[model samples]
Target: MFYGDKLTELRELNGLSRKDLADKLSVSEQAVWQYESDKVTPRIDVLNALRDLMEVDTSFLFEPNMVTRGVASEGHIAYRADDRKSRKKTRTELTYLRYVEAFVDYFEGFLTQEERSIDSLRSMTKQQADKIQYAGSQREQNLEIENLAEVSRNYLGIQSNRDLMYKIENSGVCVVERNLGQEIDAYSTISKSGRSYIVLGTHKKSAVCRNFDIAHELGHLLMHQHQNIELLTNEEYKEIELQANRFAGAFLLPGAEFACGFATLARKSNPDYYVDLKSQYLVSIAAMGHRAYDLGLLDYQEYRYFSGRMNTLHYRKLEPLDDKIVPIRPGKLRALMEFVLKSRLTSVDHIRSLFHVRPQFLINLFGIDQHFFDQFEHEKHSYYGGAKVIRMPGA
Candidate 1:
C-alpha cells in the first residue's frame, strides 16, 4: 500500500486526469486504479516518477494517516472512512469531492514542504478553515459576487473563475440542495476540513440558479474556510448560514462602492423599481431585496412592494416561452479544457481516449453541435466537429 492512498490526491492537485497521469508514468489507468485501491503497489520507479511529476517531497506520500484530533464532522468522517471508500470508490457522486480532497492534499503538501515554514500547518490550515466557516468579516457583509470573487482571488490565490471553482471543491466543502421546485438554494457543508467543498443544486439547473448557488457556495467557502470540525445542530447551521449570507452580500455588493452607482440613479429614479435594479446590477430580484434593505436604500414598505413585484414577474405574459431549453453555459472546467486543446498542451484525440467518451460530448459541452463547426474549422476551433460526447473533468 506504499503511496496507495496518496497517489490519487497528488494527481488531482496537478489537475491531471487518470489517463494523463498514466501516460506520464507509462501505465494503464486501470493499473493506476489498482495502485490507489491497494490491490497492488507502485514500483519504486513509479513512486519516483510521481514525486517528480507532482513536484513534492517523497515524505508526503508516507504521511501516517488522516488522524483528526479535533471535533468530528462529515468531512472528517468521510476522509477517515474505510480507506477503500476514501481512496478507491471512484464511481459515486462524491467523485468530484474526492478530486477536491486530492487537490487540497496536494496544495497542503506543496505549502508544507516549502522552506519548512510550517510551525503547524495543520493549525494554519485549520484557522483558515475556521474563517471560511464561521468568522464573518465586515467586508463580506456588504460585498457583491464580483467583489467576493475578487477577494477570493487575492486572498486564496484564485487565478481565474475556473481556479476558484477548483479550489472550492478541493477544499472539501459539502454542497447540498434544497429543491424549491421552481427554484433551488444551496447549502454549504456544516463541517469542512482539509478540502473545501459546497453543497449546491445539480448541474441540470438554470444559469441564474446556478450562478446564485455558486455564489452561495462561494460564501460558504470564504466564511467557513477554518472554523469547526465538530458536528453542529440545525441551529448552528442556520447561524453559520446567516454569516455566510452576509459574506455573500458584501462580496457581491460593496456598500460604499455600489452605493455610488445607486446614488447616481437615485437622483433620476426610485431605488424601489425592482426591475430596474435587477437589470442594472445583473443580480436577482431577491438579491436586490436584501441589498436594498441592508443598505437602507429602500425602507421596509418599499422593499415589501418590490417583493410582491417579484411574484408577478415570475408569470407575466411576455413573449411565448421558447421550445428549446436554454442550456446553462459550460463553466470554467470546459473553458480550461478548450484552453489546453487550443494551446496544444494536449490533443483532442488524446482527451477523447482519456475520457472514454465519444467526441460529441466535447461538441455539446462547448456548444459545437447547434452551429456549423466546419466553417470555423479552417480558421480555428478548440474541439472536434464530430458530435460525440467528450470527457467531463473528473470522468
Candidate 2:
C-alpha cells in the first residue's frame, strides 16, 4: 500500500504545495490531497509522473516513512539571515536537514566509524556542552561569550586563524553551502542525536565573510544550544544575535593576538593599512576595524573614520582581496563518501538504490557537484564483507 506520509515528506521537502504537485501531475488539487491523505491512490500515470517529477523511484512511495525523530524545531534553529524567513521556508530548510541527517545515519552504518571524523567530533561537542556555564547578567554574558570563543579555539587545537575552516570540519560539524536566499547568510542546528550542522549561504561568496559566518553559527551551536529562541521576544533574539557576533569576532581574532597585530598598524584609521592585516588574519577590513574598536586599539574617532572610509571605498559591500581568497567548501561528507568508495566498502549504485532517489536528488542532499555523481554513473562493484566478497588473486 502507498504511504501518504512519505508523499507528504517528499512534497514538503520539495517546498511544493498540493496544488503545485497537482498541476505537475495534470490532476486536480483535491486528487493530490486524496493521494497524500490515503483517501485514494494515484493513478499509474500519476505515479509515474510523480516519480519523474520528484526524481525518486515510484516504489519509494510504498516504503516505510523516512521521518526521523528529535529534529530541531524551526524556532530552535539559529539563523544569521538579515531578516526572518517565512514559516514555509523554515519548514523546508528543517525538512531538508532532517533528510540529510537520515542519509548520514544510513551512510555511517558501513563504518562502525568514529575513526570517522564526524563521529569523534560529535562526542567532543557533547562533552563541551556539559561544561558550558551560562552567566546571569548582560555584562557577564558578554564576558562568557569571549571565554567560550577562547575555549572553542582551544577545543579545535589550532595555532592560527588560517586553519579555522579545516579545524571546524575536523571537529565533526557538517558544514555545507546551499542557496539560502539573499537575506540569510548562514544557520546552525544540533539534532537531539548530537549531530551539529551548519548551512552556509551561496550568496556569501567571500572567503573572509564565510569564515565569519561559520564562526557566528558555531557560537549558536555552542552558546544557544538549549534556548527556545522561538519563544524569545524580538529584543531578546537580537541580544543573542549580538552575542554570536561578538563571539565570532573574538573567535576569529583572539584578543591578545589581534591586539598585538593592531598595535603594529601605523594608521589605525586607514582602511588601506587594515588591508595589509587582512591577508594575515583572513578577516575582512571592516571586521578588523570592529575588532580593533572592541579591543580599544582604535579609539572612537579612529574607528568612526575607518567605518566612513570603508563606505567611501566601497569596501563595505566588497572588500579588497575578497576575490583573492577562495572560499572553502564543506568537505567532511564528500571525504567520507570517497573513503567508503575507495575502500570498496560500498558502490555508488548501492547507495542510490538504498535511498531510492536519483543522482540529482542525492546531489541536493549532499551539497556536492553533479559531476561527482556523473563520474560514478557507469561504475559497479561487488559488495564485500557486508554481503559478498571479491577475491584478489594476488592476495
Best by TM-score: 2
lDDT, residue 128, candidate 1: 48
lDDT (10s digit) by residue, model 2, range 274-314 = 87789988888888889888878889998889999999998
- Give all TM-scores, in the order shown: 0.46, 0.86
Cα lDDT tens digits, model 1, 336-394, are 34443454445645543433323443342223333322222322322222323334344
Candidate 1 stretches with Cα past 4 Å from truth are: 1-92, 99-208, 227-230, 264-272, 312-331, 342-395
The lDDT of each candidate is 0.45, 0.77
Q: Please tell me which predicted candidate would have the highest lDDT against the true structure.
A: 2
lDDT of 2: 0.77
